[model samples]
Target: MVRCVVQSQWLIYSKHLPSISTAKRHSIQAFPLFAISGRGSSSHTLSADDNAKPLLMGPLDNVMPRHHITPKALFIPASSSSKEKILKILKSGLAQTIKAIPTVAGHVKAASNPIQEGSMCVTTPFGAVEDIFTAQDLTESHPEMDYDDLKRRHFPMEAVDSNVVYSLPDLMKAEKPVFLAQANFIRGGLVLGISLHHSFGDGTSLKTILQTWATCCRGESAAPTLTESTRRERLMSSETGASLDEFPEYATIPDNIAGYQPGVAKGEGPEIAPEPPQVDSHVFYLSAQRLKGLKDLASAKLEGSDWISTSDALSALLWRSITVARNLEPGDAATEDTRVLNIPLDGRRIMREDTNSYMGNMILFNNATTPLRNLLSSPPQLPEIARTIRQSISRIDEKYIKRAISAIGSVPDVSKVIMSGGTFGESALTISSWGNLHMDWGHVIGGPSERVRVSKIPFPGVCVILPASEPGNRSTEPNGVEVMIGLKSDDMARLMNDPFFASFAEWRCS
Candidate 1:
């Protein structure tokens, strides 16, 4: 067993087990993690010949955000072992996993094609293990908090700050790491935070990485073997170039918009509000029974032949509740205003190919719009609203996906294009469903995680649906669903107090 002593807001590991040197500890706290490299063996270095070549960027990859992805925090329950032992296991597993997916250990560089000037390419370098992972001793700082309390509350904002759970290079730097992970040793458990560059991959890709890492940590053989071609493939248009006239998703907007930057390429950075609004995040849980009732209510007015999925019903409920919470006055102006719901549609299914092992962004938005009056009526037209969302998403077929790919490829400078449907704010909501992700890490951590949270929501009017704690761990009905939503402070307050909303979703935290 390993012993730990707390002194001066730092953890001092016993001599029997390897301990981080004083210099190394201070360096971890003072400097950016990515800046500390080359401490590992020379074998970690990439060959000059291999390093000279760059991987091609997919059409979807070219239009993704270039900055760091919103970090994901996993709240593991307390275990019997010491924090040092857990950290060692996590780090070792991560090192092994990176060996299989080397692209994630690489850096994002500028694409060579002049026409695709704003796009990105990736290249691996030496000492990737040392540069991408770090551990911080937080037991001394948060001595009073325990696993149960932390699991029930919202993740502390300070824990998500730079150099704490993760770090990033200067925006203007020529290259940046595609993946980063940090382990925070708290009082009773650990918070393992992981971040991936938007250009590197999507949520599905991240899911694969997490599962493989868990398998490695469990000392299991037969962890999936992924090669460069198997993990990633360059996405191109069948028609060398296509026009955007048929694709309404990509548009050019004025610089005065909320996310618009003067010289920065469109879709390259997080959406920033000139004067940041007061937004609050809350997690709401809907039990299986409540979800079924909601679906029945939504389908009451639909024709027998018409069908609406459980996701469609849940999204419809959220959209109507949020709209009502806005408390728009009853008038022509309020009725004329529109509420847009944007749902991200994964392309793997539409392509009719087995891309379960494929990694990278393959997503498009399903824009569903409805007038405020319809959503805010005395008796809301829920069935119609749900049908609208369902139909919008159903429109995305293989042909449509290919056309979108071709249209995005036609852009000379991808940074100049923006989503034309609408922006995310008061009048719009963007919801992404991650309920299908396999989040069980108990095999390695000794117990299932009580909660999983995204470090932050990039903008207001955004929400993420997280998976249940156990896979198929249900009784009588499916397990409950957890939704993390970010909205203006006042709107969130009204939403929490709304009786109709409370009838279904139980508010867990701010």
Candidate 2:
């Protein structure tokens, strides 16, 4: 039984307010992940790795990974001015987007290990933008926008299941970096959140680059780019690299699963669950002030000695949301003992320096556990629930990812009739990127909507947040963080209707 005492700081805020300013800043966009072969199969394999534990144990061999082309480009124009702009953006790490094939092709070519996994970011020799500016002008005119308030804006709060394509200026023969990010507005101003490929980089690196780019745009001091060796390459290792035969011990699916039916085996790919006929979708933008308020209130609820993060608070709320919805279902599988929260961990920190930053669909690892179960029952133990969240985050490692990848790829991939060249699919629930956005390209440079697909990401059951727009970054009074509780339509309805779930959520921000 976990006991949580509500601190005065967290107890004072209301749940909803008219303006984003009064509420916690939580503007989140949604994206979903879809396997190339979309269908749900029954045979499961849980991952046994420090970072990933959801993938079940199985004979995983001969799996060719998939790669999506970046919709944007990074090209320096041939003109001297354009070249200068490119240099400026690189020096400061912020350049106007120029979506083209040649530049990104060049980056793809630069990869030392282009076959399986590799990534590279470089300035094209030359590229032209609209008559207003050249790539070079962008480089020299200002530094990247490196402000905390600014950089954090360009990342999507939720990394879900769907494909994405960001904008790049359509320069004839000229190009710039094409990312999966878009530009938007904040408090009547422009912002950017480039939630690119999940394989390219981890959240920390992505966020750092966003800030660095903002600083570059603002003409601030430049941030040094990581060395090429460290910047990319090293994500792929031959099956022999780590003896792909070693599977984790705790990699088997349990006897019973929640929110799912029994024994329909397809394999380790996404099951094609029918989306709601009319899913209610909306994008909410958060202001900096509202976010801070939620954080403050959440902090107030904790002991002075305890430290928790906004992400932590939100995770608790969402987890509770799921439980609440499940409890309402008149199902045999709805047992309090069989729930788990799967967290995606970017194992970059755990790898060697050379591979740490290397990009290219490196791999998948998870950190998941049954969160504080006591909270959803009769009288919620809020503090204990918060502590459990704090503790669950403590156990994450890189070997888990490597091992999981090895195991995923190790499966013989048995198909009665094999396709010439294609991988399989598995139905899953994924959670990535919490509270991130991009306003620079969409709003900063100010381009047409066709220039980018603002909400192309489509991952079901995802939890996303607008970083700086949340309560911690902006708020003065007690309040809960403004977060988009994304779930399949059915899941959403159950969540809002249940009291324990909503109460669990309200307490998380405190």
Count the clashes in each prediction: 2, 143
- Cα lDDT tens digits, model 2, 1-510, are 001101100100011111112122111111111111101221122122311211111111112111122222211112223333433443333333222111221211112221212122233332333221222122222234222322244223221112222333332221223233433222212233243322233344444444445454554543333322122213333232332223221121122324333332222222233332333222334334434443454455576678877666555555555555545533343344434444544455455533432323332333344523453554544444545666655644455454444434332221110111001011122334432423242112332111111232233344444333333332464433334444556765666666754443432220
RMSD of every candidate to native, in Å, equals: 13.3, 16.0
Highest TM-score model number = 1
| Candidate 1: stretches off by over 4 Å | 1-52, 152-163, 168-172, 221-225, 229-234, 239-241, 253-273, 332-335, 423-425, 435-438, 442-444, 469-477
State the TM-score for model 2: 0.48
lDDT of 1: 0.63
Evaluate residue 103 in candidate 1 and report its C-alpha lDDT on the 0 to 100 scale.
73
Where model 2 places Cα greater than 4 Å from the true spot, the runs are 1-195, 202-205, 227-230, 233-278, 281-310, 329-337, 348-364, 367-376, 381-392, 398-429, 435-459, 470-480, 500-510
